[model samples]
Target: MAFEEAKIRFKGSISPVITPFEEDESIDFKLFKRLIDWHIESGSHGISVTGTSGEPSSLTIEERELVMETAMKTVDGRVPFLPGTGSVNHRETLRLTKAAQEMGADGAMVIVPYYNKPNQQALYNHFKTVAKSVDIPIILYNIPGRTAVNLEVDTIARLAEDCPNIIGIKESNKDFEHVNRVLLKCGRDFNLYSGIELLCYPMLAIGGAGHISATANVAPRQVAEIYNAWAEGDVTRAQHMHFAMMPLNDVLFRDTNPAPVKAALGMMGKIKPVLRKPMELPSKEIQQEIRETLMQYALVL
Candidate 1:
């Protein structure tokens, strides 16, 4: 699809889902399928596999393909499927984006190039080039903390203006000012999905489309509920729900992303808290804290 066409087709709350592994520490397709079913059943608008939360860095190309294939087959058109296609190198990124489109993914979440920290012109050209390379819509993922370089508002506005395929951004910076600026600079065609879970309600109030949240991995229904209620103008209900989730969100990141999320999932008896090497399980103390919070929220065993 053309950029203009893709823009119209993509927008909403999507989770950067966790990849589950069996006791042998391989991608566990059964538990993976169950996790997918849980997300869709809990009303997640879409799932972005092989993302940060999915430990894309740890996954090989074949492993990524397995997760994407399983997610597409499981969701099966019930919800949009978005897979992470960001890499530091352009050629690799294009290969993945094209792969995502070929595998019947609805869209691709392309994060800003990390490590090398390209200048503004390079950033613009990078996204434009990859976006032009594929038929699918491309949502820019700009979480500077992870990537090091931030996508500038002016450049982002320009990208949205020039590249019709560059539809939206997941602003994970946790800076509401930045989110507001993006909303102001780009207007409605350029959707801004909150990358940070805690800011979803506030972001929505300022015209953000929704979230690409990590917290959704543990409490899909609770996080999705805030968006649903806020959209319907139920501010009181939304605020209550948002407040209730702060501790849960904090716990998910107490270790570092998917570790805490995977640990929490294990505690819930949903999946084993298995992560790839170099990323260990959260400490027992952290696990206790997560359990206590889950108890407080009444979300545990």
Candidate 2:
């Protein structure tokens, strides 16, 4: 399918799923596949792999390939698999982008360059180069908090205007103003997803497409329900769900993300909470707190 079509079709509650690790801290293929199946079965509209939540930086190329391959195989064309193919440079991003396209991913989530911040032109060129290099659709990821270089509204507009494959974005900064700016500036075809779940209703209020959420990794139903409810015009139900999830959302991200998410998943028997090197697991106190949050939500038995 065309990038724009894919973006328009699956524009809601896609999870940047956590990569499951074994006790040895290796990728657990079995658990990973199960998670993918579970997400699909649980009603999440789409899925993203190798994102920040997926611990992309810590994964080896081979490991990255493994996760991508497993996700593609498990999803088996059931839903859109928008894997994060971002890297610090164009070549690396191209390599991963090409791999994802070849593996039957519906599209690639290309993040802004990190560590080596690039100018606006460079940023434009970086994404342009990748879009030109790949046939699959490109979903721009603007999580400036992690990358330290925001893909500004103008830059995003430029890319979306210039690059056909650059169709959508995952906006994580939770800045509703910026989100609205993108929605206002970009054409109706442009799909702007809220990477921050807290901004889902606000984003939807501003004509934003949907959300790429971390909470969905644990509460897929609740997360997806918020979108469905809102779309169905049940704003009250949607708002209630979002407010109900806020406390867990705050604690799930109390530390570096995915850590708390993985920790929460561990409590739920989803996976081991062992993050890769340089990414520590959440503290016991924090874990207990997450567990309490889960219990309160009745996500735990």
> Who wins the TM-score comparison?
2
Listed per model in order, the count of residue pairs whose N, CA or C atoms clash below 3 Å is 2, 0
lDDT of 1 at 257: 85
Model 1: residues >4 Å from true position, as ranges? Answer: 1-11
**On residues 1-301, what C-alpha lDDT tens digit does candidate 1 reach at each position?**
5656555445456877899988878989898888888998998878888888999888887777778888889888888788998888788798889989898888899989889999999999999999889877888999898899999999999888887777899888977888888978988767788888788878878877788899999888888888888878999998998888888888878888889889888889999889999998999999899898888877885
**After aligning candidate 1 to the native by TM-score, how far in Å is the CA of 142 from where it should be?**
0.4
Residue 273, candidate 1: alpha-carbon lDDT: 86
> How close is each model in CA RMSD to the real structure?
1.6, 1.1
Colliding residue pairs in candidate 2 = none
What lDDT does model 2 reach?
Answer: 0.86
Which segments of candidate 2 are over 4 A away from where they belong? none
